[model samples]
Target: MIIRKDNLLLLPEVYLIIASIFYWVNTSTLFNPFAIIFIGVLLYQVIIKNKIAGLLISSVFILLNLYMVLALISELSEFTTSNNSFIRLLVFGVLFLGLNLIASIFMFKKHLVK
Candidate 1:
């Protein structure tokens, strides 16, 4: 289908909305699915298209994935924490993921507008 330039804003906005809801709801898993898909797409861009922007975003995506995986593993293993610090970390991680996704949106917009 045709993707309008203005409509392109919806991609990042949707990510922002989901992240906001997860943060407000005291949940941290919302970004993981998006991260997984993003990682694959970034890799495709890097390997097939040799896109320079994909390199940086892919690195950021991996870091975000690492944080999520660690948090998940700790929770799954019943690792105890004195406070809800891990939850906070997860929230921050999701925030960064959203920010990076937002940045990628701008980068894409730049190329598309050119």
Candidate 2:
């Protein structure tokens, strides 16, 4: 099998798509159509290796993840001493969101350099 750069770049997009699916499942809401649309555009950018569009989408991804991380951090702090399922969920959210944020930043850098 051949693994190209574009294929490798699909990793973050796939992760975000899966995360969005989980978000929709858990929340039972389609209130964030903008994100869904952006993700579709981001996938297109990755497939075509469009540097400008990729950078723009990656910037939006990074900002959204950062905002989520900060919001989770604020919520987590309120239950720092608790040992509950919700706390565990928040911790995992923060961890995965941080990873997502880092991946987005790296993706953005790659687009910028190209």
Candidate 3:
């Protein structure tokens, strides 16, 4: 069986979907439209092997996650008093940032290097 390298791009989407579900559960939000919209677009772009589209989608996610990371850091003290919530937010923010960064870098290399 041969494995396609492009399939690896699904990793970030899966993580984002799971994270969105958790966010909904935690906040009791009705839905997360951004997750649905962005992940769907990213999946399509990846399937079609469109490097530019994939990079752009992943870059958008990266920016969103970066904003979350910065906001979390800025309000660190607000949650620090509550260890459980603070840890949860920190982990979620960092993981989201890291996963998007990885996807963006992968797309960048694929788009620019070869």
lDDT values, one for every candidate: 0.54, 0.76, 0.65
The positional error of residue 36 in candidate 3, measured at the CA in angstroms, is 2.4
Q: Which lDDT tens digits does candidate 2 get at residues 86-106?
A: 677777986789778877888
**lDDT per residue, candidate 1, 1-114, as tens digits?**
998965654454345345445544564564566545554554455345443554455455446646766775666456376357767766765666657555555545544544
lDDT of 1: 0.54
Number of the top candidate by TM-score?
Answer: 2
lDDT of 3 by residue, 1-114 (tens): 776765564565555556655655666656667655755775576467575675676677677767877787887767538687788877877776677567666555666554
- After TM-score superposition, what is the CA distance of residue 113 in candidate 1 from its true location, in Å? 2.3
Clashes of each: 0, 0, 0
Q: Can you give the TM-score per candidate against the true fold?
A: 0.32, 0.78, 0.65
How many backbone overlaps does candidate 1 show? 0
Candidate 2, run of 10 with poorest lDDT:
18-27
Candidate 2 matches the true fold with a TM-score of 0.78
Span of ten consecutive residues with least summed lDDT in model 1? 9-18
Candidate 2, lDDT over the whole model: 0.76
